[model samples]
Target: MTTSLVRIGLATALLLGSIGAAAAHAHLKASTPAAGTTISAAPAELRLGFSEGVNLKFTGVVVTGPAGVVATSTAAMAPGDDKTLVVPVAGPLAPGAYKVEWHALATDGHKTDGSYSFTLKP
Candidate 1:
């Protein structure tokens, strides 16, 4: 009886822990022209993949490059993919280093933000 109770307690604890983890805020999982990579050609748009679905209305990214603030269109969720945020670049990016700052609101109502940098080959 005691062994059975111990097993039940462990099982309950594991279940509760997993539930808590599932509620975590969205996290950046991947990106186009990926972090710390050098690309010879400019990307017309930026694609950001998150760990979970995000609310498009509450998510965005700000890109800054060698010349300063880069122009980008309003962010949108990739069609049929709520976990990916797509932002269009207004024009070509100059050769140099660029930093992308992003903030996201998960569908679950949790918020998260982060930044990454990449270099453009001349």
Candidate 2:
């Protein structure tokens, strides 16, 4: 009876583990021109890293500053890296606070979104 119960418990644990893995969503892991830091010069491109591989077709970023919406080129995944999103700035940014809003869909079909802020110094 004890052996049977142990076998059942192991089976349950394996099932739950697989479910948790399948439900994983992409989360922001890091960034260049990173969150909350002030930089002297604007970066030509923004790089956002995620906890899991994301679908580039379903991921995007919107940046806003004191002037209003900033222009950015289309976003793309870094070469050989499915977990990093790279966005190119269309022009130099004026010194001010900026917010980056992003949304991503994991390869597994889970969606996630979040925002962060940074500043440029004169």
* Per-residue lDDT of candidate 1, residues 1-122 (tens digit): 69999999999999987886677679999999799999999999999999999999999998999999999988889999999999999988999999999999988788999999999999
- Cα lDDT tens digits for candidate 2, 1-122: 69999999999999987896776889999999999999999899999999999999999999999889999998999999999999999988999999999999999788999999999997
Give lDDT per model, in order.
Answer: 0.93, 0.94
Cα lDDT for residue 38, candidate 1: 93
Give the worst 10-residue stretch by lDDT in candidate 1. 16-25
In every candidate, how many clashes are there?
A: 0, 0
Candidate 2 Cα outliers beyond 4 Å, as residue runs:
1-18, 21-23
